[model samples]
Target: MSVPSQVDLASCADEPIHIPGSIQPHGFLLFLDAAGRIEGWSANAPEILAGQLQLGLAYTTLPLPPACTDLIAECIDLLAEGEYAPAVAAVSIAGHDYDAIVHGSHGRVIAEFESRDVPADTVAMFAVKAHSSIERVRRQRSIEGLLETAVRQVREFTGFDRVMAYVFREDDSGDVVAEARRDDLAPYLGQRYPAGDIPAQARRLYVLNTLRMIADIGYTPVPLLGAPGAAPLDMSFGVLRSVSPIHVEYLQNMGVHASMSVSIVINGRLWGLIACHHMAPKRVPHAIRMAADVLAQVMASTVQSIEARSDAELVEQSAKVRTALVESLLIDEEPLDALARHADDLLAATRSQALVSVHNGKIISHGPIERETAEAIVRAMPADASDILVRDKLGEWPQDVHASVGKWVGLLGLPFDPPGGGWCLLLRTEQIEHVSWGGRPEKLAQVGPLGERLTPRGSFDAWHETVRGHAHPWEATVLANARLTQSELLRASNARRAQLDSTRAQLLAMLGHDLRDPLHSINMAGTLLERGAVQPTLGRRIQSSSNRMQRLIGQVLDMSRIDGGMGLGMVFEPLDLAALVEDVIDESRMAYPSIDYSFANPGPTCVRADGGRLGQVLSNLLSNARHHGEVGRPIVATLAREPGWAVLEVANGGAPIAQDVAASLFNPFKRSSLHNPRNRTGMGLGLYIVAQIVREHQGEIAYRHEHGQVVFTVRLPLAEMERAGPT
Candidate 1:
């Protein structure tokens, strides 16, 4: 046959140019001019020209019959106009029909040919067949629908007992989604077959061969070539003949005696299969099989279209759901409730049963399921886990109430930690039908707990039979894409955490280094002054500086500890509250002699507390009052014992903290205002430390503005102190 220009004939010029073997046995070539007139013919042209023309006649120059002549002319015109590529068609020569092809190159028809010696009826039939195929393709609603139709048509036309469009599952399993069968045959429309049934080696062969047939499972194989240097003989059933006998046996076990499969390739990979099976041994002519193969090609395109559309829809839906969830989390403040309300809809959209769990390492709040049951699930999952579809059964749940519940068939966990110290668990349950493998017959008889009466054999008998014809349901590409998205989100979250940690470390280092230098200088000056080693005025100034430095250093350390998540140890004791307040007052007066201080203590008051930390709390409050309040105003220090705790109040006539500032006052390094730049000397950790210390003592600390005065109070639990007895 004459090759198309696009076929790169030059590449094969040096080699013996033999025709590519095809199921269609007859081959012919005809050369045509740009104007559609035949120019020349190959030496084999007579095979096609025999019955239609006389010997030595120039068929190329002769006017063709109207039936095929117009069709050829139209093809030539389209090719010259660059509308058609090298394409196949059918034409009439004399009273006979011949399948023909025209090859175009350099804006001209280079070659054309038609089969010879065909009957007139076959020629007319061929033309009608070619037109029908083209029309069917052009009228398809969608690629998937088109492919489905194509497979059905092939099965009907080829008289295959059972034909199916089998697609690969994400886990490599195969499923039959579309099927056509004889009236007496049962359908396998949705049936799923295990990956092992196909085997890696078998799958590779299917993809490589593109089309294969086991004409007769019991047929004695005919070996095309013998072993190297071996004598030629009837080598049927030899290992080298064709398909392995082992595979044939496997097919027979599945009740299929004869089978033909064509690989559906998408994006250069084996996407699935178009499979035809027969229960009885059958023989199909080569031409008929070639026609079926062409139909399969059309089906492949349809499959691609369907897959693309489905993917687009999935992506759009996922985007919407993910956006809603994330927005509610960052913007709504109450994300948990929002998620709970929308949980059902979200689960349905994803075709999953979702569970959300909130955990703080020790405490957990499970969604939907019982807390104990949820906790058990969490414990079963590993931290360095990946998403999976669990098919094996989980025998029993940890909680007794759920003892009779069927084992968990499938689970997917996605962990997320919110802004605070809690984790959000996104879990999905696998569909029962999928997990049970549609209830295979061989494994159904196995007994388990909940009594033998409830064995899989009995429980799933109806379901097993019902789902036998159902295809496996899974979209591997979709899940893979989702996993990639989740991984990216996790990576970003980890990166942000690392950045925050680095910033915190740098800030702590800066604070410690900056504060230590001043503290050392002040301490040295204080020692000299206390020893009378400086002038009286200098000594007084040195003492004040030393006290200020000590306060700064304490604030730095306290802030550091809190930020570092260090827990506090409380040495609780029943102490005389009155005496403690009096001592705090005496110390404050001694340090700020110019500042007036008043102490009011309920007589013989007693409570429990860590004395040193409490003293530090009192000192920080008093110092704050002296530094920020009216400098010379009297600072009131009051102590009293209520039913369950001791209360200490430190008040001064200072500018009251703003509402916003008061809310965050206990936060480290959070100051009231930046109005007084000169007084910004403190690191803003005093009150924060005070709150920490009081909390360690099992106390509460708070501040409120009252009558132009700011009052800070510390209330400690009395029973805690009493239990400790002494520090």
Candidate 2:
């Protein structure tokens, strides 16, 4: 005989098995229409019947006696009620006995007959075995446990040498998660089979036909010959249907003489299969196959129940993580800082190796990564990307990202342009998997006349491949949980901003009241002075009120300028600090002659500063001392020059600053910082303005308690002062 064409065998996967027109000759098949007429019959149909089964003839006219007809009619009625109609009826036709099976679907009926006395109690016996197996399957607490028990029970029930729980992964590739086999036979447990092993059409058939059995791999095919004008039969539900030639070759390559598989349907989808294989030719009876189908049904429900519980736990954990991140943000003033606080925790939660967070052009990372890699990732990402970009295999990604990610196998990107720029990317490293395929993966594709062809490998030996740049796939729940985190953080950021806005509004209202009180004092003093009824006290009060108004206006303008990011336009010059202090004190003496002032400077300390701003700082400090100083005690001002620094000290004998109040003493809009009741009415902006000026001049200011007195000191670099020389 000529050699079979390798090309034809390679392309056999695309074969239309549904209309293959032939079936295994183990049983005879008859097709009936909606009216119960014999519309078609297999080539072997005449073997079991008393005579030829005439096409277009009513099935009732057949010589299948009353009891067999009634059993078939009852099965048909049950099928109409959406229940699986039981077959296995006894028929006595023309002095010959036959075991018949009936199935009704889609307004068509198919009945098959075998020349055997199928045990009269086979259905009852199978039911008892099925119930026992289902009870065992139900007792399993996890999907793995359920699959393990299912394979064991199927192996025992079918008497196959090996039975495996073939589960499909997210990529549609399958793996033997659990298995049961004879000790002598080598195990196929945990071996991954490529997705091409089972074609898409075959998966569809598994959904329609839950039970499939092959008595022997080499059985002759029985063809179904339709009459003229008849459509080819749809054998999707055929039990003894002829197997796909490619699949047959595949089994033969694996040293299997017979095989059977039952579909595990979960949530109306084909989840996996309970595959049974025998090394020697074996014939599994219909009764055993029926028992296996029931076991699969129970297994499907058990798997779904276990998954539901696992999903519930995952959701609970995700909620807890989100709550913690939100609570962290609630107390934090900066949104980015809050997100950074949970960076490590969030990275661990996603089960990734690393995470990167970008906020307003600043980047924070939780794992070991190079700056170039981070910039590469940011470059590849879309600016307005709102959806999570998840990749399972980094090697499969576009070259731009693939090269950048390096050994990282997976990534979950949450990119968003928040004003300027903000995004987050989580990464996972490759898990080098040494997968064991059933056959030599290299031989599966051979160099034929054409470049490459899909061919069954000759050796069913263990094959190894070092899978690189690919991680275990991310679950849907993981992506969803991360998405939820991004959304929660965004909401938290908005809430924090709103809180700040409310605080600003309250500050504005307070400023309105504070400004009005000072304005009213000036207005009353000016009116009294205009009427020539102003005493010395009234005249001094008017001057003090006017000075207070000018100070408040300057504080507001300085705040606006600082917020606008405008640096102080300093006219730096050599200034005599001792002389400046004397002038400020003389002015203060005129304003508050009741309070004594003393001044001292070791030398003429000349320094560089914005003279106007520096003088404003000194004036504010002296004013504060005057208001909060001990009554009848002299306020002392001293300037001293030290190595590379100029020090200014203003000390007053009064209550020291409270620790809590001192902490925010220079923060804008902080509450009153004075000990006197009258001084508490001023806007809390003078110290803030002074602090800003000091920072702009690159100087340091601090408060200290010395000998029951509150001492404020200023320290500025004296490098330039030394260059200018002592005055």
List pairs with backbone clashes in candidate 2. Answer: none
Q: Could you give candidate 2's per-residue lDDT for residues 111-142 as a string of tens digits? A: 77655444647656756766788799989998
Off by over 4 Å in 1: 1-148, 170-173, 196-200, 214-259, 267-270, 278-287, 312-352, 355-367, 381-424, 434-727
Error of 1 at 700 (Å): 24
Q: How many residue pairs clash in each candidate?
A: 9, 0
Worst 10-residue lDDT window for candidate 2 reads: 1-10
Best-fitting candidate, scored by TM-score? 2
lDDT per residue for candidate 1 within 1-727, as digits (tens), equals 3221212223322121121111112334444445654433333444435343332334344555554455566667677565344445456654555555444544334333433454546545554554465357546767556656666766755667888887776667777767888878655676676565565656665654466666667755321211222222211111112455445655665577778777777776677787889998764533355556566665667667776777877777767766665544432222343355456655554555445444334333333555665666656555554443232233322344234222333344444443423333444443345432322544332334322322222221112433221222335654654565345434444554565476467557756666676667677777887797855666556665666667666665656555445534567776776787789898777866888899866776666667787787888888778777875678888877677777789999978787667656765455343224535566556666777787667578888888888899888766654444568
- lDDT (C-alpha) at residue 30 in model 2: 79
Instruction: Give the best candidate by lDDT.
Output: 2
Against the true structure, candidate 1 has what lDDT? 0.55
